[model samples]
Target chain A: MAADETAPAPRGKVTITEIARRAGVSVPTVSRVVNGRSDVSPATRARVEDLLRLHGYRKRSAALPSRAALLDLVFNDLDSPWAVEIIRGVEEAAHAAGAGTVVSAIHGRSGDAGEWMRNLRARASDGVILVTSALEPPLHEQLRILGVPLVVVDPMGSPAFDTPTIGAANWSGGLAATEHLLSLGHRRIGLIAGPPRLLCSRARFDGYRAALEAAGVAIDASLVVPGDFHPESGFTGCNTLLDLPEPPTALFAASDQMALGAIEALRRRGLRVPEDMSVVGFDDLPEVRWSAPPLTTIRQPLADMGQLAVRTVLRLARGERPDSPRVELGTELVVRASTAPPAPVL
Target chain B: MAADETAPAPRGKVTITEIARRAGVSVPTVSRVVNGRSDVSPATRARVEDLLRLHGYRKRSAALPSRAALLDLVFNDLDSPWAVEIIRGVEEAAHAAGAGTVVSAIHGRSGDAGEWMRNLRARASDGVILVTSALEPPLHEQLRILGVPLVVVDPMGSPAFDTPTIGAANWSGGLAATEHLLSLGHRRIGLIAGPPRLLCSRARFDGYRAALEAAGVAIDASLVVPGDFHPESGFTGCNTLLDLPEPPTALFAASDQMALGAIEALRRRGLRVPEDMSVVGFDDLPEVRWSAPPLTTIRQPLADMGQLAVRTVLRLARGERPDSPRVELGTELVVRASTAPPAPVL
Candidate 1:
C-alpha cells in the first residue's frame, strides 16, 4: 500500500453489498464510482468513495457470488415479433429472480455508445444482457474495468473468448426445414435466406446445403436468393426466384416474415399456397398460426433463449461463470397446413 | 419557520436546477426528497436537504419549468405490433428532443404500480407517458404532488380531468370501414369488434352501427359480435358469424389482428378472401400490407399518437397545457386488395 493509501481489508472480507449499505446508494452506483465513471454526480461519488475508503474496499480476489438488485436488458431494435418473444422471457426470468429490469435500445447511431454507457453508469445496473448486437472490444474493456457482468443473445459477430452467449441451433433448424420439404417430394426447392453476413444466417444456409447433399439432390445456385430477414426481402427474393427459368415447387424461407412475403408473391400470381407451391418458414412466431394457411415452420425456442440469457447474466452478475460459455437451445419442426406434396404436374 | 427548519431566502425564487447544481445531486433526487419519497438513501437525502437550506429553496407560486433529464414510458403490455409502433414513435420524439427515455411495463400486477412509481421517483423523470392503461386516482395524486407531468395514449377509460390524452378518431375510422363495405354492394356486413370495456372499442362499434343506420340497413344485433381485439377473438367471432342462418358476405374487423383471424377462419371453410367473402380491417399495421390478399383497412396514425404524447407530456412538464385536453388525430381509409364487390351469393 502507498504511504498515503490505507491498506484494503483482507480478501473476501468486505462485500459490495456492505459498502452499498453504508454508502446509502445502490450497489451498482458503488461499482460505478469505484470504476471512475464520470457520469455520476460529484457529491454522490464522493459519498460512495468515503464509504469505500472507510471500509478499506478492494477488488475481489476472485469472482464471487454478488447478487444485483437490477439488470439491464437491451435490444438492437424492438420492431419484430421476434423481439417481443424475447422480451417476455427475460421479464419472466427477472420477475422470478425478484430483480427489476431496465429496457433500452441502441440503434447504432453516432454517439449511441457513449449515451448508452452513461445511462448504464447512472442506473448502476448489475449486469447487461444484449440481444442481437455486436460486442465491441472497447465496451468490453470498460465493462471489465467496472466489473459489470455482460451476456449476449444471438451475438451478431464472434464474441470475445470470455463472453458468455446464448443462441438457437440455427443449422439444425435450417436442415430440418429443408428436409421436411424434401420428404414432401419437392426436388426443386427455393431458399429465401437471411443476410449472408450474420453467423446464424450462414449456419442456416450451410444446413440447407447439407440437407440437399444428404438427399443426393444437386444444389442449384438459381434456387437460392438472399433476404434481409424481413417481409420485403422475402417478397423480393420470391419474385427473383419466380423469374428463374425453372421456379422451385417448394420454397423454404429463413424467417417467418420472409415466408409470408413469399406467400404474398404466389398469391399475386393467383396460385394457391400448398395447392401450387409448398412453403416452410423458420421461427414459428405467434402470428403464423393464424396466417391464411397456418404456416409450417421451424420453431426457434426464442423465449427459452431469452430466459436462459437472463439466468446466465444473473449468474455472471453474481461473479460466477456460466455452466457453459456458449449455450445453444434446440429448434423443432412444426408441421402445419402451409407445406404438403408439390403439385404432381409441377 | 420551525426552529429546525432554516428560513427560506425568498418567495417564488430559487429553481430546481440551482438547488441541484449546488447540491451536486440530480434534479429528480431533489424532487424525490422534497416529496418525502422513501426510496432515496437517508444520508444522501439529508445532504440534499442541507443544500436546499443553504440555497433557501422555496416552492414557486408560478409554474416554473423543471426539466427532468429522463422520461418514463409505461406500456400496459409489450406484446403487440400496436405497442411497437407507439414505442418507436415515442423513441423518435424523445430522440429529437434530446432526452433519454426509460421504458417500463405494468402488467396490472398488484405491486407493479408501487414498483413503477418508485423507479420513476428514483429516476426523477421529467414526465411520464402511459399507453392504453387507466389512470388510478392515487397515482394521479402522487404524480401531481411531485409535479411530474403525465399524458396518456389511447387511454382505456375516462381519464382524470387534468390528464391530457391522445387517440385516433376511432369512431370515424369504424364508420369509414363499414361505409366502404356498404358501398361495394354489401347489405349484411358481419362485424368483429373489440372488448366493450375499452372506450376506443365502443367508439368503433358505434361507428359501424352509425354507418349501417345511415344506409337504411337494420341494426341487426346478430350481425355484430364482440371480440377482444386479438386473433382468437376474430376466429371465434367469424365462426359465430358462419353459424348464423345467413353469414354475411362481407366482414369488418375492429383491428388488423382480428381481421387476419377472420381471414384464417374463412380459408378454413374453403373460402378465398375477396373472391368468396370481402374483409376489411382497422389499424393498417405493417404486417397487414403483406397479408395474402393485402387488407383494405383504416389507418390509425399510431406513431403520430406516440409522438404527440411525448410532445404533450414535455409541454406539461414545462407547465404548459396542451392545445386541447383530448387530442384525436385523424384516421384515414387505405384501400388495398382485400375488399371488392361481394360474391354474388350469401
Candidate 2:
C-alpha cells in the first residue's frame, strides 16, 4: 500500500533551540549568542563552544566549502590479527586525512560477496581497498562500476580494474624460508600453503617449489599440505603431514597462526621444535615473537604495508595519481630460536 | 534536490517469482513445489527445499508463522584480543539459538556520536549488545528508545534503565588481589586503577580500599595511581608510584595490559618482578600468561559472560523475561609466576 505523499523535508540545519537543548542552556541566550547579540557571559560562551566541539555541530549555513571525505580499507577477515594491525594503520591515516573508513571483511563464503555488492551499491564509501586475494569476477565488476579511487592490498588485480595494489614479496619470503631449510641440510621439507583461492597462497607455493627445484630436490607432493591460514587448520595439516609415509624434517608454514598450530601439533606428538622438526612461518604477528620458545618466521613488513596503504588511499582520494599502481614491500627472514639445522634422523 | 517518490509496494501474497528469484530457481519450479504439482522432478524439489532451508524462504500467503532471528552484537572496539574470546562465546551461543550477529565498532572521536547514531539507526539488527566502558547520555537515551533487546557488557547502567548486565565480579576480584598481597606479608601495597569514568574502576577501587581496611592497613592516597587500562598508562603509573619516597613493595594493576606496562617499567629501571616489587594483574589475557616469567592475575570468565549476554539478549528479544536480569560471573585468582612474597627488605 505505497502511496505518494509530499511532506516538507527537514533541512540539514542546526538551530539555536537544538544547541541550547543539547547544551542544557536557555534558548534566549543561545539565540542571542548565535545572532551576535552579546548578552551571553564568557562562561556561557565557553560552555557552548565546548558543546559544539563535542557534538561536531557546525552551522549548516556557514559559507565555507568542505572537502568531500571517504576512505576504503581492505581486511582479510574480521578476526584476523593482520587485519587488526592494518585497520589501526588505515584508521590513523584516515583520521589524519579527515575522512571516514568503510571496512569489509572478505571470506570464502559466497554470501559475503552478495553483502559486499549491497555495500557497494549503497555507495557508503568513496574508494575501496580490496584486501583479500585477487578480486573475484563478480566483485571486480561491481567495484569497477562504482568507479571510485580503488587500491588493492595483498592482491594484485587483473587488467580489468587496473587499480593500485600494495603487498609484500611473498614469493621471495617463501624462497628464503625454503633456502634456510636447505642450508640446514634438510632433504625432506614440508610446506603448509594457505588457501588455493588466494593468489598470495599460490605465489608462496610457487616460491617453495622453485626453491626445492633449484636445490635439485624432487617436489614430493605428499610433503605439501593445504591449509586455510588458521591455527586449527595448520594443526590439522601438520598432523596429516607428520602421519605421512616419510615425514619432512622441516616445515614452512605460510602464516604465523598456522605455524603456531604446527608447533602445537608437534608438541602434542612429543616432537620438540628445531630438535625434531624446525618450522618457519610468515607475517610475524606480535604473538609469534612471544610464542613459547619464540617462532622463527619470515617477517612481512605489515606495519609499513599498512602505513603505505593508507597513504596510497589518501592520495587516491585527493585525486592524485600515484607514481606506481603496484607496491611490493620487502620481507626478511627473522632467524629466531625456532629454526636450526635439522636434527639427525632417529 | 530531495524528491517525494513512492512505488507500488508488493502485496501480502507470496509470489512464486519472488521466491524463485531469491532462491535462484525457475518460477514454474517454485510453483510446482508450492502447489505440490506431480510433474516436478524429485531433484528440482530437493533443490528448492534446500534453498528454502538456507534462505528461510517461506510461503507468506500460507498461514505459517515466521521464526525468530538472531540479535546484533554492538561492540565498542574489536581490536582488543580480550574481545575476541568474548565474541567467540557470544557467537557460539547465538548460533545455538538460531541467531546471527552484526558487529559494529563505535569508538570514534567524541564529536562522531551523531554519526554513530545514524549508523545504528540504519542497522537492521534485532538487538544490540553494548561492550563498552561508558555510554554517552544522549546515545544511551536514543538506544533505549529503540525498544530493542539490549544487554550491556562491563558497564553497569544508572537506575534510570533496567537493562540486564553481565560482567565479572570486578569488586571481589580487586579485593582478592589486595588480599593476596596482604597474605604475602606486604603492608606497602600500591594500586593501579582503571579510568575513573568506568563503573568497574569505581567498584574495583572500593574493593581495594575495603580489603586494606579489613587488614587494619590505612589507605595511602599517595599509593593510588590512575591508569587508562593501557600498557603505556600502566608504565607511567608505575613510574609515578616508584618515584614516591616510600614506594609500595607490591603493586596490583587493574588490567593485564597495564600490568605488562608496569612490568616493563620495572624492568627498565633494573628491577626484577617479585624480586624487587611483587606484581598482580587483572584479566588474565592470553599474552599475560606467556610474558617473560608470566603474570599472576584475576581471570574473568570472559567466554561465559559473552555466552550469557547473547542468550539473555535473545530471550529479551523474544519478549521473554530472562530468568535473571543481572549476571555477575566470578573471577579466579590465577597464581602464575608473576607474584611472590615481598623480598625481605633488610
Q: What residue runs in model 2 are displaced by over 4 Å at the alpha carbon?
A: A1-168, A171-346, B1-70, B156-159
| Residue lDDT tens for model 1, B148-251 | 77898898977755888899999999999999999999998999989899999999999999999999999889989989889989998998998999889899
- Share of true Cα-Cα contacts across chains kept by each model: 0.37, 0.02
The sequence of per-residue lDDT tens digits that candidate 2 reaches over residues B151-234 is 888864442467788878999999999999999899999999998878788878888899999999999999999998877788
Name the DockQ score for candidate 1: 0.24
DockQ of each: 0.24, 0.03
Clash pairs for candidate 2: B70-B99
Docking class of 1: acceptable
Alpha-carbon deviation at A134 in model 2, angstroms: 16
Q: State the iRMSD of every prediction, in order shown.
A: 8.6, 10.8
